[model samples]
Target: MTEQTSLWQDETQSADFAELCSALYEREIAQLANADIQSPQVIQGRLKSLPYYIKRTAHLMLQTQTPLDLDVQNASWSAKQAAHMPLSGQEIAEVNKWYLAQTLTHGLVVPVATTTHIVLDSIDRIDQQNHRFRTNVHGWFYLNDTEQKDKKVNANYRLLKPNKRVMTAACTGHCWVNDHKTNPVIPSLRELLLSCAINWRNFKQPVIF
Candidate 1:
């Protein structure tokens, strides 16, 4: 194993992992906010509010993971679904961080040109009408253990409260064979964040039920 791999394995149960997650989150958020900001003032405000956004994202993830009266906002059909997940609480924290990082990164750019257009349009609308334009990332993950050997993980991201929670953008997701221990696909926090933002848009509009 390489030195970096050894370090990753060693830090799986260490504070270093948590710190790495935090750092990665900050970097990802900064990149997203910088890329989408409408003005310098907006960028300044986003930078100032970074901690709040990060904290809110972390809290939401924690809340979703916790069972409330045996109900989770996002849950797999069986505990077996999470079998591939580590049982360690500390490690779970790191995993959650990783998930959130990827989710946020992907959430911002899933719809490609549409995402940017929407953000810019919202900014224009806000400036023109002095109204609030809210957009957020929401999605779920399911562990795939089908007969097929590949695509062991599935995740999607959609616009939150697409229409006052009465409607939402259709989810866009992809499958991956995640085996970080060997031939790690996400070797570093940078890669983890970078992977979240794809060069292409792979999404469809929300379908109202």
Candidate 2:
């Protein structure tokens, strides 16, 4: 007797995923009331420089056509953008289309002892290293893409890893990944990125939010 494999392996699972992602995006947007925590409209108004600002801040812009948040980058992209060159919307959509169309299970939990966390509208990434295990932890909180060319694409990225250690002081253009020769050399490197989107209802009137 032949047994059937998972639908994801059959392609239907991936198709379902695209639909699921679209639905999730909508659910996030639909909950946006002016009084809601994650109001889409309020987020759009608070737009600022893209990329870094997008990462360190809890700002998420609402889109009219699609459920995706606005592709945000600074008025100017940081050096990383010029070197690595982040993704654009069309590119992302294409990826999402492929990803959502697939069925795969990634990291899962089995109810072991886990760290507790709080939700902060403003978050910070600090680099701490020791002889044993070096970690960039997203404490109290932990947690996308967008387009344009005039500046670097409105990439939403975080301090994936600590940049200070990478030290761009003597580099070609103050770029960590690209400039520093020593940066190219590292041991057991683990880079993690995190972001947060504030509930508009919480800090609506504030200039910062």
Candidate 3:
């Protein structure tokens, strides 16, 4: 395992994982506010806020995991504590989507799109003015065991696979995936929508209810 890999990783189940995601995300809101995050800032502010979000989420997800040995690393640190369980991949993805939603809030549905899905569970808005996409779409959700799988060029950046080995974004998703943030926070409704923006737009949309 890479140094980045958690020794005490989260293997928690779906419900617990969901709760943990919510809690950590709530904590993240405070951290961002304390950092004075307002809109229109560069991506750096978002990036800077990440570790706290990821680490906190990670801690919740992997309850068996203790925090870093800050003294050994010479990092001024928070006190050590433990939770009842470990986080799981679902939780990680949940929180990850939360962060992603926050990042991708308002986008003009680009034209030349391949699929027609328009909304996921938490869609915020469809910028009617800017969307040049050819097809009209409704929304879509995971119908069953819920999976996505495909392959793509590093260039376009749309993830083609839902359950690929790395499951996060391609290219390590430095901006997107922070395995470090493995905890109990679920993405805010908006964040969750935004994170799954593509699915919201492509897989979920184009439906008629």
Candidate 4:
């Protein structure tokens, strides 16, 4: 077996495998982000190609028994039982960095036409003109309440009151819009990460969620 293949089979080297995969993933993200794309079509094409690149990179880095067949739409591969092996402290940190990069990439991608219905779970009234709210699925949104009147503000609050849901479209500039005529809500990336159970502050530890 090749040295890399042996490394994959060695349970003790699981951390090393995780580190390698994380590095490769980071490199791919960097290359994609730094590319000089002159047009929207080019950007879309690159985004479309990311999945295949990820699959191929994982298979090559893991040296799995069954190589990932890119031709098959649903083919999948994973590192042997070692995939479930607990990662070391450093490995966890490296993995978290990769996760953060992935999230940032998601934020950078152009918004699609699809819209989702999200139920508001809670709200934090920031001030007269701005507020923040959390959703059950999508995460936190920053609502700009330009209308300062208490009656109008209360009406807007009622529109997004807890337990009330609305149709939302993800847009550029981290902005999300509801089907209702209310002002557009911008997503707070930090709070959004927290809502997803990822704490950006403690990258040194493994994420329990």
CA RMSD per model (angstroms): 18.5, 22.4, 17.0, 16.3
lDDT of 1 by residue, 12-57 (tens): 5344334534754655565665585668887778668756655443
Structural similarity to truth (TM-score) of each candidate: 0.26, 0.19, 0.23, 0.22
User: Higher TM-score: candidate 1 or 2?
Assistant: 1
- Tell me which of candidates 1 and 4 scores higher on TM-score: 1
Q: How close is candidate 1 to the true structure, as a TM-score?
A: 0.26
lDDT tens readout by residue for model 2, 30-96: 4333344476656665332223332322122221121112222211101231232122232434433
Clashes of each: 1, 9, 39, 0
Superior by lDDT: candidate 1 or candidate 4: 4
**Model 4 lDDT-worst window of ten:** 163-172
lDDT of 4 by residue, 1-209 (tens): 69978877685446544554455456556766888878989888866876565544444434422222221121221111211111123232342234334322112211112232222222222122234333333343333333223323321222221110111122111222443333333332222222223222432221232
- Candidate 1 has its poorest 10 consecutive residues by lDDT at 116-125
Residues 18-132, candidate 3, lDDT per residue (tens digit)? 5545555565556556765457475467757765655544333333222222121111122222221112343424533533343233342211111211111223354333321
Alpha-carbon runs more than 4 Å astray in model 2: 1-10, 34-41, 45-209
Candidate 2 clash pair list = 14-101, 14-102, 37-199, 37-200, 49-74, 50-73, 50-74, 51-73, 71-146
